[model samples]
Target: MKKNKAHSALLNRYQKLINISCDLASELDLNILLSKIVRAACEVSDAEEASILMYDPNKKTLYFQAATNLDSQLKRGLVVPLDGSIAGWIVNHQKPIIVDNPQKDKRHFDYIGKITSIECKSLLGIPLMSKGNVIGVLEVINKRGGGFNKEDQDVLLALGAQATVAIENSRLFLQSDLIGEFVHQIRTPLSALNAAAHLLKSNRVHEDQKKKMIDILEAEIEALAEMSSSFLDLARLESGRKQYNVKEFDIRDLLIVCHEIIINEAHKLNLLFILDLPDTLPLIRGDRKQLKQAFINLLNNAVKYNKIGGEIILKAIAEKDRIIITISDTGLGIPEDERSKIFEKFYRVKSHRDHVPGTGLGLSVVKQIIHGHGGEIDFTSEVDVGTTFTITLPNEI
Candidate 1:
């Protein structure tokens, strides 16, 4: 009878492991995948809480990436020394460990418990390995059964085994996507450059036409360089690698700076620039530089696709708990069919491909920034009428 019960327990664990594998396989978003992995680790190990610490090989440090208790911001940035912590030990040794008395264990890092205000009685940590390299550590703490046992360790290690592959696949997917986009975008500028060179090489070219060819060469080259830079920025932002310097500041000041940055370009196109804002709008909070980039892209697109003598309006106002900022332009509006894809990386409206000089990454970057700040962005447009982007941001207390 005891032997049968043992076999039954093993079968149940096998089923749960299979279920976890299926869940991880279907998830592609890196952040969501990591969060789910942590939760699954907790479930499989029957632990109260779980977290993942991503190792920085270059820095020789381990930093908390995700956890069960997110309200503890302190843990988010908390770094564990590669030489000191239990997670670090698992990472260094590339193995799994179960410590029933972490308080007495010299290898354990106690500061994490302090940061989250959760007492740690025991822990089971395993190395997240991919291609024989230790990328991170998976740790489940405070097992509800009082102490982590061999079964708990086995379950977490199994989860860790799958987590590493999922993380690598997600990263590879991101890189493959960005690389494909860059390759496709580079072809446009290269074609222009070739055409410009061919025209300038004409034996009977007049000075006027030669000058025009040179101008095209310069503009196309500049566009290519800008595209490369924007691609890097978008890659960093999307990968959760970019650190946001979040703070509270006046939204109007940011809008003013955005206006100053792009107003000259708008005026050069014989377009009217209007700023609509009350003098006493409430302050909003976010990364100043990132938010600035978001506005710059919106206003830049407004001018790039606008009619020759069009008008651009930037307006900001406050609601009860949220702030709304609208950027409207009398420009060539996006097609109804393509509007949904406007925020996709490297997606440019087919109609505007030739007329617009862009990397098609601006709107996607803007969307990433807004979503990063726990805000929402939306738009409305028609073919020839115009397009307006509405951004809703929460007011920070």
Candidate 2:
């Protein structure tokens, strides 16, 4: 009777934990979801602290995304190797582990203690698995009272399952939203083309006026055709219908090609163009044509948004195992809040909406192409200080 009672109590506790996990998983905000997971893990496991490590597949490293007791910003982006660490072991095995004394374990990594300046006594880690693959590791360090037990392990596993489902759902939702926006963006150009065709057919205009109208019609038609082709290419890359053609190419030479292609336009604006690239750059593996298109789109934006007599700079450097390329301009900068949405398909900073004309798919297409190559594109801008777009691609490819 006593044993049965004990088992039932444990089961009830686990049920409550599972319910909390489900609630946390429903959150779409990445930061909130991470915080809730850490809090729930600490509560259910009765641990002193909890931390979530997200796996970056491109870097093949584990990074701290959130923690209950550590400095959140300090812990963020702290990378851990894939070998010789407890978290790494869990990731590799896709299983749960409970260590009562981490100091005695050969697999325990002491580097985290040095980084966070916190001593770890015990640890319970479980792999966050989705679709039969490990995405990351969730861990509770130093039980508050006694050591973690089988019930704790079971509860954490259940929580991991819920978190995985939620993460997968959020990713899918983001992708769907992007595709919808892409579809909506193509409509504007299509409408312009239709109007131009209708005007050309009208006979009310004089010969000189008709000739000018024909020119406008031709330009609009060409814009529509170019936008359609670019949109289709972006859609294929985003939907995984097409794969990146990765290869080794010189970064400097690529920038020179972009400058050569856009030199006339730069001259029209009277903008001084500068290129700062090293004489010998390591070979970067990526689709050369796609990357060139991304550069051209960014350079075009710089030129389009610049005031007369402004300057544009193309800079490149090798950082760690990644190559960083930046295109900066003395043109109008993006607003702080608007920076986040710039990569969304058909999204343009409100500041540029009236002053500049674009299909709004340029940055989105750039983001997709960079992401397809397993790289990242981000920017920093001050309202009047100007914007600089930084792209980081792996040195290997």
Error of 2 at 228 (Å): 12
Steric clash pairs (candidate 1):
none
Candidate 2 structure lDDT: 0.79
Best by lDDT: 1
Model 2 residue 111 CA deviation (Å) reads 3.1
Candidate 1, 53-137: lDDT as tens digits: 8876776778777788653222343467777789989988988988888889887777767645788888889888878888889
C-alpha TM-scores of all predictions: 0.78, 0.58
CA error at residue 319 for candidate 1, angstroms: 4.2
The TM-score of candidate 2 is: 0.58
